[model samples]
Target: MGDNNSAQYVGIDEVPSPRAVGINKVSLLPLVFLIFYEVSGGPFGVEDSVKAAGPLLALLGFLVFPFIWSVPEALITAEMGTMFPENGGYVVWVSSALGPYWGFQQGWMKWLSGVIDNALYPVLFLDYLKSGIPDLADGFPRIAAVLVLTAVLTYMNYRGMTIVGWVAVLLGVFSILPFVVMGLVSIPKLEPSRWMVVDLHDVDWNLYLNTLFWNLNYWDSISTLAGEVHNPKKTLPKALLYALIMVVLGYFLPLLAGTGAVPLQRDLWSDGYFSDIAKILGGVWLRWWVQAAAAMSNMGMFVAEMSSDSFQLLGMAERGMLPEFFAKRSRYGTPLVGILFSASGVLLLSWMSFQEIVAAENFLYCFGMILEFIAFIQLRMKHPAASRPYKIPLGTAGSILMCIPPTALICVVLALSSFKVFVVSMIAVIIGLVLQPCLKHIEKKRYMKFSTSSDLPDIDHITNEGTLLG
Candidate 1:
């Protein structure tokens, strides 16, 4: 791990040009909120669990799990972000606590998730774009969408954060506003009793768990970048809270309203009846417009991931974890090389249908979440003295208490979900584990020597001994 105690110096002689080399306050919360809100959990068939698992499973997820996993996850990230606020969010924290091996595990998963997920976005975008038509997400069209998203977002990231930030603002707004309108209109139509249904009782236990995995994972991407934010101690916490709030308003509401309006889950995928919630309540003619809007929402989300993942991969490289090539950058300080590598993965997966992408990710997300929660827990114990301006107030007991509900729920979900996807995720993680030794060996070659001193050698001592420059 890079030194967190590294001096924060700036001046003509002390530093180079005083340009912004990192994140800024361009309303990161809105974009961050959109990351959690607009995409993953909603259109990804979460409501199906409610419908399939009966009212019981849906309630556990939408209501109970949010209270458990979502809130605490956000809060912990808030405190961590404000305290460290460096570059590669949880990867930085874990590296500080455990070591580079574990840190790279998280970072590699994060980057790989983005890369793998890139394929899903354009296909979703195409599906939304052709909502009025049929089979647009098939074959060449899906491939084209993948290329376009990869090309455009990669270029924007290659350019600079200023460009990406503005893009985020636009995409966040464009994505959420229409969805909000649709959801709000559909709200009054919901039956309050529908929230209480317990559909999973007689169903297969494993099936129910697999179903729940669809919703229980993926809170790490933004949180991991906690260190990169301005005033992360304050900003990240607020961002997490705001994201949860907005997710309900912009994303979940649509699902609620759409479900209420249509009263079916399996059918929602075919009709995309959620996008039509606005037309059902407020405007009939808005159907096509909303379809266009949903496509934009998916596109915006894709761009956000592309920009963030590029930075994440770049940060990992700078620490000697990844190859030096990933450290290569454009004049704009973007990691074009890493972005290209990531985009290649995206392109390869784009050929698969959206349903397949969602299925595989469903399982991978569960595994990732387990690690993320572990990262948070480890940091508190290991980095006890680290400044955490915005921390979860629960302390050790609270962290432990908060841990139970989410952990129990995840265990339940895993025990219940599709065996195939679960097995696939296990295999992927096993692949990673098998590769760790090689990565460590490569890392050793880069640094060459292990620590020999009781204390970390001072920068001057290192300079005298022909080590790193200050």
Candidate 2:
């Protein structure tokens, strides 16, 4: 932390208010779709979705998950958030009810999951770029594109959130277009008979696990950014619901609508091609729109990823889990050190193990879901009377029931991720475990032995007046 003891609180006349500083509604809503839809799209989405079951079975799973799983889980999130509105979204809230160990675990998983999963964005982007420009499919150009995109995003986020939100909103708009074209044009082209004649080899249990785990992953990210939101409780819950509906449409409709437009074979072969369905309907000119959409979709993810990264860094630093330097924030409130750490990792990851990195994203995703399940159960039971604008109707039993499908789904995915990715994930977790104890020991030593010098400059003093102000 900062030298708070050396610098008096300028606003000690006013205590920190939990209400206004909570989360703004505007940022929260769009973010929900941004995080969710990315996981549910493209060749990847289709692969996970159709591998074990086909469109018919995929649809069945989606239908079963929402009422049976999503609704109750969302409700649990609503209650936990409202009860601990003062905490900086999930990290603080989870920390409060479950203790710092679990809290650190949540934050760690969220950060790593985000950084690891983001490896796919550039790879997928390269795939989309190459799909159109066939020669660029393999060499330096492909690697260059990944480096450029990631660097620029890291820069954009380093500048701060205004840029992040602008990018997110535009991305949200851009990302949806291809899906729109794909669904609107594609749906009409489907023949019901095709559904019956579907091929069976797509049924890979591992692929389905990877696919669906991502389909519904990390939506709680918006809640984490709630500290920046305007009307968090009201805006958060409503925005979350809106994001869900929009995401479901953004994802499901494309597949549904595309059934009519592209041949099943064509759809299966392309990377992130719901936008391509528009070209099928509107002609070659639609490619521009789809490309624009792909760029925008990636932008949405970059914003959330960057935001989550900085926050995780700051939170860890503030709690003394990380070095003080990593927590340092720039004038724009960007976590300069933390942001660099993430960006560097992104840069390094772009070069090494990009393929395994892509698959491993699902592994980190599973770990997050498990934590959310734990948080959901614990917070609901601990803070029974907590004022919540929304509540999952199912008391403890119902919430537990809702958690099961997702929990089981995630567990299976953890196993299903390639032996390489699964092993890497285990290694990463073990590294974290090793560091956890060292961090605790270090913090304990500091708490017992370290102290700042008394000669530090004070921040509360008036500049021209040369007087300390209350």
Candidate 3:
């Protein structure tokens, strides 16, 4: 541990240099769109918020939920990600502050949560298309659609982050443009009173909170790709800030137009309701555009999420948390084994209902976030003078206070889960706990190779002067 009295800290100049030639690093614009896809794929799934609560509560949730969750998580990620500046991301943070055992647990829960989250996109993509092609509503046709879509998107991820990043930029623009036009066209028909409709007693607290949490969370998913980013210390924080603004507006403005332009028929506000709203406000042309946009948006979300999940596995492997095979990269600099594992997980979980998927993933995510908050606070208290290229601007006490609201929100989300989801998520957690020791035993027996990368800095050896010791 470093000396707390040390006034000196490591400078940005000491951070790792950029990767050698032949690998293209992600820059600011692509990084922002990547984060946008990671968190909110352009309000495609947010219509459920209005269905669960009224427009007023849904609007307030998007506005206030950020302060309670997104901001805190993003700030912690910015500071912790820049400090470590490597692939393992939060896993390294937890291992450095707590221990490797807990770090592995964090990796398992988070990666599982991410895979489960990725499964939702193909389901969402089909939901938009089924309206136009009624045959895709169920049966083997939907299953085949999911398979084909997942395969295509997985291939895109395998191509490389730079390609995925630019694709996200194009998809984001296409996905968001319809909503912008819809908002402009709906102005003549806008009903201000529609925005204020709410019935407190009738709200589905479970669905409402879950929907809000799902859309606004995952700001930290970008951290897993910090190593692939160009100048992450400066770029990560800036991308997160711009993405936050884009995401909030993306959800809120479309929601405002949809709710205020159409009548209050809560039952009608489901997954693809935005397309219907476009048709009602403008015409079939606008609706078709919205539908196509939603379809492509899910594609954007799938590739972005796959990149984060797969790279996280590679990151964990580099830190020796998993077997060495996981660290292997494809010719395009993508995580070969990790992408297959993540894509397979997505295929397995694709059959679950949308609500079930959201709840189960959210439950698992809550557990991982609890560990992250503990790690953040522990590092702040134990290594007060450590170098942080993008600090949160909070002291120890202030940091603890900052984490309180989000932690409380996590508790609420976990408590509201269905008993079935609770049991399933707990079983997954238990597997992680057991799997860690099993891997360790295998490593001891030389059953599979497990080695930390030589290039990573030693987390346990901070000098008294506050620099990382070689």
TM-score of each: 0.79, 0.81, 0.96
Could you arrange the candidates by lDDT from highest to lowest? 3, 2, 1
- lDDT of prediction 1: 0.57
lDDT of 3 by residue, 7-101 (tens): 36654334453332468999999999999999998999998999999899999999999989999998998888888877878888888888999
Query: C-alpha displacement of 6 in model 3, angstroms?
Result: 12
For residue 325, give model 3's deviation from the true position in Å. Answer: 0.7
* Cα RMSD, each candidate: 6.4, 8.7, 3.0
Q: Number of the top candidate by lDDT?
A: 3
Q: What lDDT, from 0 to 1, does candidate 2 have?
A: 0.59
Error of 3 at 370 (Å): 0.6
Against the reference, the lDDT scores of all candidates come to: 0.57, 0.59, 0.90
Query: Which pairs of residues have clashing backbones in candidate 3?
Result: none
Off by over 4 Å in 1: 1-47, 54-60, 183-198, 201-217, 224-228, 263-271, 276-284, 443-470
Question: Who wins the TM-score comparison?
Answer: 3
Tens-place lDDT per residue, model 1, 354-413, is: 445666665565555667677778766654444445556567767877877877776765
